[model samples]
Target: MRAAIANYWWGSSTDNRHIHWMRWGRLTAAKCQGGMGFRNLRHFNVAMLGKQGWRLMSRPESLCARVLKGRYFHDSDFMECTRKKHASHTWRAILAGREVLGQGLIKRIIGDGSLTNIWRDRWLPQHFNGRPITPLADQYVTRVADLITASGQWNEDLVRQVFFLVDAEAILRTPIRGRGDDIWAWELEKHGMYSVRSAYRLLENQRLH
Candidate 1:
């Protein structure tokens, strides 16, 4: 299953450059694009799992957060947490995840040993913008600050309003069709509801009445 998923993600091309290009494009369209229209399962998995990381970074008081602080971080920010000179693969992976959160993008090459130049250029501004907070935006700003701190990037507190502002702008600029369509359609066919939200509401109504 894992090998199949990896093959689907990386494509069957033996040439390294072609494989890289296909991975970069994520997936191809069928008939019109002259290829099978397949989704990159690895990318999809990362995107979905990234939400859980967001939730974890959002809720600092959660048990998982507490455990992480006690075990790996020891209450230090992610960047401050240190292991042996040569860390294990698991440690390296965790650090990589933290680096991604710190960078806010996955464009940088991994295993480079040094932070990329683009990181310095992009991160500083984002960090500075996160600093100032108004009365109404304090909670969201604090959350962004926590994420920043945990990621060991910048100290600025990005206001939730501003974050959402950029988010809305991006959504408007680059439209996405069939977002979550596979998951929703699968659920609807199997369980008669398109989402957990509708299913939960139905159960709640039955319990109450």
Candidate 2:
């Protein structure tokens, strides 16, 4: 398909040899950057797969998710699931998409901090990697729940003690509502809906930079 598109765009000369002017990579750049906003097939494919992966993660109760979970990831969630030795092509594709999701997904903590790990999860918004930069200060306080009081309030003193000054400030700034469950949200989308365009743009930007 890519070859055909390139052929069409850079048609053959009189000698039947293609007269390419610009490279395909440059042509795939966004129009604002001076190139046509053509989709880079590989990134676009992964972005599309990322949308499918998002659907699976968001709609765990769906038949497709249920079936795939039962077969490939019954013991773990989609984002953390691994590729088995004999995994099908579809599963591999979804996992590839999940990688893209991992790049931009973050847990939206709603006061109930049981779902996130204090150090492992990307819940810290201010940090560059969305995680606390401080080394673990205490051995026992491993989960975000440990930093929350019984009344659904942050244990300010405990948090400050558990992290460095910067991380403590970032954690204290995170507003925690009394919502029932913490949820994963897409950082690239305002409404948290995963779309191919957003994922594609993210991939493109990452590649360029």
Candidate 3:
């Protein structure tokens, strides 16, 4: 991830003389494209958490956010809150985990359909025409599928709700073809009704809510 960010910021030199300039977007292409495929850690971190923001915004009535607010935040931003005077190793580990996971490859899919459908659709095998789920992609695919199944609804209103919750204005702007598709897909795919339901169920199971 550091290498990728460095490459994006500073162009690689070729043959110890020539300089090869690569734009941030182009440099971020998958490894198969001859790029390192490292995601910008900060950007990916924000993107990953954007789903949570979307959830809280979309479901203000949800008990999870309310509990979180009362526990550590007290109506303050999560990033700004510092209730822990000394950050524990667990907290540092969590932050490190976020950095590592966020920098890894992200596979995003988008379609003008329900979030469940978009998430459940699969990629086909090389030898077959029809889509066949593979174990390798199952982790990511299942994560999305489970999220949609847990989150109940996916509609424009939910999008707006999340947008306001995150205090992000870009969601209101016209969507860009590729970039916007990924961001929008990430939000809708992860924060649907299924996700909330699953979280609520977990909280109930743990007696945390």
- CA deviation > 4 Å runs, candidate 3: 1-26, 29-38, 75-209
Q: Residue-wise lDDT of candidate 2 within 76-171, one digit each (tens)?
A: 888788899999999898888876788888887875788888777788774778898887654687778888888888899988877889988999
What clash pairs does model 3 have? 149-194, 150-193, 150-194, 150-195, 151-192, 151-193, 151-194, 151-195, 152-193, 152-194
Per-residue C-alpha lDDT of model 1 across residues 121-147, encoded as one tens digit per residue: 222222332223233333432222232
Top candidate (TM-score): 2
The TM-score of predicted model 1 comes to: 0.33
User: What lDDT score belongs to each candidate, Candidate 1 first?
Assistant: 0.37, 0.84, 0.37
Q: What tens digits encode model 3's per-residue C-alpha lDDT throughout 1-209?
A: 66545644564444343344765555645577676565544455444444464454346568976766565567654334554656655444333323222222122333322331222232211212212223343233232222222233233453443333332232223222231222222211243232333332232233222
Every candidate's CA RMSD:
17.3, 1.9, 18.7
How many backbone clashes can be found in candidate 3?
10
Residue 39 lDDT in model 2?
A: 85
Q: What is the TM-score of each candidate against the true structure?
A: 0.33, 0.92, 0.25
Candidate 1 runs further than 4 Å off: 2-37, 79-94, 105-209
Candidate number of the best lDDT: 2
